[model samples]
Target: MTQEKLFASFLLDQTQGVEIALRAEQVTEATHIQGGIQKLPGSVDFLEGVMHLRDDVIPVINLKKRLGFTPDSYTQEAKVAVVSHFNTRYGLLFEDIKEVFRVKPEKILPINPALRTDDQAISALIKVEPGKRAVELLDLDHLFAGSNIDYTNEEPPHESTAKQRTYSRYVVFSSGGQEYGVSVEIAREITFCREINEIFRTGIVAGAIELRGRTIPIIDTQALFTNSETTELITDEHSRILILSAKNCSVGMIVDHIKEITTVADDSILPFPYSDNDNVKGMLSRLDGENTILLDVHNLLCNHVEAIKSMANIGNHKEQEHEDSDTGAHTVTHHLITENCYLIFSIGKNFAIEIKDVNEIIENDHVMRVPGASGCSTEVINLRGEVVPIINLRNFYQFDTKKKSETNKLIICSAHGQTVALEVDKIVTIYKQEQFYATPSLGNQLRSKKDTLDRLIEFLNDQEINEHVLVLNIHSLIRNHLQLETTSRQAADLHADQHADDTITEQAKG
Candidate 1:
């Protein structure tokens, strides 16, 4: 009962003091550690195997490479502990678990005077305060004593209990702070900040949300777990706006608002500690903290569900990803960007902008050069007569295309007003996608998770060659350059206002 003596008559000091003695059926959930393991369980690098639990699969030991540089080994920083006993619950890969106590038999003590037990593996000695700093208690069975294998007992299987369930869809959200869910037919509504023209500078859908009148893609789900949030832009009000739907476009998700959706029954299920992400398939047990969580809705169409039906026929206009504070309306847009540099070239190898927003480099006659295109789509300039969509930065990056001095230009852009022409080879001056921050998507177990811009559109079974930096689509290069000058300026202003109202009705019938 020593979970600090059974939560010491209650309130366990709101866990700020910490406590986890488990037994109310082992108190099943908790997540944070995030990594561990360097090579063990049938190695070959299934991501260095071991260090996952929520369906259990643990075995951690890096307490920061055994307290910083332990005889040299485990690296990726290390920090895993994940313990479970008799019924086995592996994972002791620590590099950082710092604290978690519930002691109380008078702060438990014992071996004093001499200290330093040869091989070292403390497990217990705690104290708390009387002199300050004395936490030793970490002998999760002698540091996993030996780590036996045979993960036999198998769990995480329940198909559909609670009387074979039927009906119950919840999708309330709120990240970094808490509140979450997964289905409700994966929530396809909740929009509000209309007029979002499009800003998907790179993917994970961070640019469309114009509500009722259409236009989707807004996904920022905490910027895919760690991009913090900035380029995925959407400002605030905590910026809600969900949207969802993926078998063919339906993405608007500028989240941070949504909050309710209930109806549990599958006997209030279990299994979902990151469920290894097969798109996080399923799991929604919470009949009041019953634990369980991996319900993700295929990372909300960023998994390339055919690029969400070609970005749902290109942002069915109404515009929302074009912020300015909603001026007098009309999909307003403006761009002359050039950061750290990346309008480079090649969809296969060369890509790394940070060169600093780049806004200067033009060699027109309206560009007009498209005898051959496709290394990643480029070369089709016309600038003034308008058609600009050139991107041959060294044959789209396959590199090796010389001769073109006079400062070799052509990089003009205007975004929503359309005007793409990125055929670089030289002209290397600026660099700054802010200054180097986004760089995640490592061992992701996919399951509904696209929100690039504050980075998060992972998917890479192999696209190496110095990878990670492929963001071209300032809204399909400006929807093929301003859908024909926005349809000939609204048909030449409705044919000059119907020829000036038929010459004032022929001067009032003469």
Candidate 2:
């Protein structure tokens, strides 16, 4: 049988309005060009630059320029398509990604030899349904041939070393025209400063923003650093909120804009000469020959931590009293808040699952891809002696699968005696619900038979920001979303059978 082939389609030039497609298997991942590409000296014109993606630096090729076309400026919509060529990887810069589509072998029409040029890259044209536009299929091998770019021996040396010095990644941002950085470990995410509810008039606390039902205090970076009695709140398109979290506390610092996410070696950071300023940890030298003030997150947030915690306790007490007083009436509203700790993580959105449901959290490393895996279970990894299928929540949730960051974490969770790893963008924090606010009783409206989310709970974090977190029903997610075997024993048996079949096939070939 002639099987169907999948292709990822994208655009190189929006002006030309031509779609180009690449074999889906060749495309590993696509991501926005964050921070900007670092220019290398004496590089080719088509060789845009090397990008610091996750841990390893990969060379980014401007596909437009390579195709003998004028390259467009890198906009917010610009994306890099990371394509794997044998053991090496190269990122193809694109204007925007369109979609991933499948077509039968018959739909691919070969290009005429008369029309083909010696340096042509498009090997064939993909036929779409009646009125739709045709897509040009790219022959990556041919396109990259004669480029004189070495693809072999490009593996990062740190991967083979056991005692390689570790570097801390930082999210660098600007506040008051000065660049500052915070460890990516504590940096949750960067978001636009919008619709902040100015309920708090406390020093440096501008207000709070309600994010996914959670209220997080927004600290005015300018006011806090300048020691101003009042916060000068300014709203603009460029203003961004850098969300930082440690332990149970979460706060957002208003920054002018996010510069880049860069890695800095621990030993390379120069100590701040003045000891009186507890907020400044050290100075990190940037590639542009400027120093970025690395802020000590703990010390910077120390003053407001207690106040935020106290407010949460007070809110919880008041809420409990109100609930107790209204108990006499038959009310359908349910406000259930437990002291159980839950681990919060982000896929495309923030979700919280009971911490007890999680076995362990580990960095995503050395994941073995599984062919024809069911549902979102496209990969598997060996955890101790057990084979755990890795489930991409983003895929299951129909979110765009971007290039995996170094900070991406795999949550090993077991339910119904079946173990699986849930891949998440990053860990937000471990949250313990201290209080809960009553939400409108959705009854059965919010839930369906296959709903993975259980219920929503609104509470205050240590910063007293109202947080609404959707509690994930891990049991439902595992049982309903994951279409794998029911039990771990069944999964193990399946793996064994596949292994045996592979071994037998190898012996037969010999």
Candidate 3:
């Protein structure tokens, strides 16, 4: 006789009737509450007290608290589900448990993007009945893997399962007649469009959605590809919104429609051709003769992240202006010093740079290759009848070379009469002298000589911004580039000298 596959799910009264399901085999036992539940000390609030079950003590988790719900008193109908994963057994307290439902492996849907934010607690989704509510299939693997839980001693699931081939799941969707894919882990949930409140003066932010009391900015994926302000997406239709969590902010990407949810073997994914499209992380072919472009959600939200930050600064500046108007100005006894302004940009998610040693910004035109120059200074461009060498900062920063884009701007600057052009992805706002405050901690990092991250970071003041902007070592950067150029010239001279010596030795032998 063949065994049957089943999924046990429960209802959470606190979460507006949202149902969470777990694999039936993973659930060891389920018991009704009989006595008082003990409280735990020095633990997270969601950790319900240890209770005796089956002659052994097991910690109970308050499902409401774990899922960000209001605390509720335990009812007589409440039951606890004992589940174990990675050798750690824990009990999950539920409002009520439904009868076990028989489901096949293919019937379960990969978690919808609408419910996913930053974690993969809910692994799958299933429709109980047509046009009825959907139940979320919970993955204890991710539930315990979060910061709230502690299971440090247990070995990772991959360590023991290494012999078995693993495939990464990807959520495939369509955009502008092209297929796109995002890793199932990072791709949160798929949601329908809601009332989108248009934000004025913010770039790339198509609108904002008030979801579950949190305001998430929406970026029209079609607008991103077309580079046009007019996103013809009808807000009222059955528009699908792919919610992505990156940089600790929830961003909703508006796609045409979700095509399907499937898994692709890791080895089968092919590298994307080199292009200026950083948004396209990679590509893979589907069995149906179609290529799915893997989208980088982080890159798509990069500009919006910075823009949102700058918007906060603008808000602070306005507030400061209003406050100053309300109160009369007074002369200060201490002389206020103005700091040098800096232009900010980022290389990746974490690395950022501020340039004070720049002259003028211009569009990147045809760059001529300098054969004998160093790797970092191999390209030169003609600007106003003068040939200027281009500095590829990625080379010095050890970042992969990104393809050039139309939006990429070159910052021209000179030190000691030597000029160079730096290519940066996006140009952040200019920080005035009084906008930011510098800490000697930056100087300490450089003086210590132990850490590679030596860039100075200045925290913005009330009249400036909310976050810290990294102040780059422009002087050091230019100096290093010049040093590399000099070293390359010296190496060329040495090679020429060795060649001459070899020729003379050959002539004498002849």
Candidate 4:
């Protein structure tokens, strides 16, 4: 049974000539700001940068930037709208959150033909609230790539038949003029770019992450952002890494500059798009000033790590060389765990992998709801980038939609040559090596056993390691929950306004 949860419901501005639906937690009431634009430095991705709420550094994003429209001014006179994801939280610097209203699912109508802007982007537009004005019903998920900062707040996850996410503490960074956040949990280490162990044919964005002795997967942040935008990288010599975990997943995010860490509430943020970008989870709460984005950890890892694992076959030759070295030839196979160990997460009856794999158990720190996510997702969380993907377990597994519960968490593990993140109802216990294994027979069945990885082997874990626990195939798992474009069909005349729906979504490649 696939479970579905209404993460949060929010209203967009009608004065903007569009009806937008915000994840319940996406909207927040601001206490200050009026007249006089505040020009803060950040990225095109966000409207501005980190701010302070009473004394805390609250991230503030601009709605104009998100809508692919230019604002007349970013003055302090603007209304501050606070948003939050399930685990992670953030705030939006809006013209007026008070303008936000509610619209019944049936009342939402796509933009008229006159509104058609792009032929490829924009799926559907809804009229929010029964008012004279209208706000664009935004597809926030497809719009914002998950934020970096973790939302789980470092709480342990629970064990259930569905997918779940925990929260954590994290840090945000600045690249070019944009502010990006990441969970301190998944971050492994920080350093400047001297020379990435570039491995050709290793996908579009990838290099190598150095662990104790092994060079794990290192995400190519430059490539990722470049693909997203046609902008250039403006960085300094001192680069930093927000390393969360290192297992079968990538080691860390190579950022331009490191920022300070902050705490947030998980109750207020919400999703943007009804369902779109798997990378972005939602936004955080507004604490007086500035709003930030909550990243989707799984989305980041999925794209970055996939470049290393899916696109490239680094270990094929490396392993063969290692075998030959045993025949008296000279060769150096780095690290103990050759392949990163990945953890298998099941939510809403769907499966996914933590970006990083782990050998030991770590606490998720805090557990809370993700704000600013879409109906497609249950919550937002902070893991890698301090913001990882927390699948709506209910949406995928049992069709259950229970909100705000104590038996949930963000589980971190090592495997699959990188770190993997997963949201869960609860976690059992970690198992030691030589006691678990992955078996091919275990496809997508739930291992009824809890407390140890061994029992999970019956279903969740494979017997590949015999007695050791085996991780599930994430590609298959993510595919289960995520809606894939099977044929790349261009949505014809999407704008209900007139021309098109403003063609907002730029896509990963665009």
What is the C-alpha local distance difference test score of each model? 0.44, 0.71, 0.62, 0.44
Better of 1 and 4 by TM-score: 4
For each candidate, give its TM-score against the true structure: 0.25, 0.42, 0.34, 0.30
Predict model 4's lDDT versus the native. 0.44
* Best model number under lDDT: 2
**Better-scoring candidate (TM-score), 1 or 3:** 3
* Model 4, position 146: C-alpha lDDT score: 53
Candidate 2 segments whose C-alpha is farther than 4 A from its true place: 1-57, 63-71, 75-164, 274-277, 310-510
Best candidate (score: TM-score):
2
lDDT of 4 by residue, 321-395 (tens): 343545777675543332432333334332323223322223344434655435334444455365444444444
Residue-wise lDDT of candidate 1 within 360-395, one digit each (tens)? 345533444456433434357654466656655455
lDDT of 3 at 16: 73
lDDT of 3 by residue, 104-223 (tens): 565667966677856667777876553676788788877887545542333445765655656776666678889888876675556666667553223466756655444566777777
Clashes of each: 65, 8, 7, 231
Better of 1 and 2 by lDDT: 2
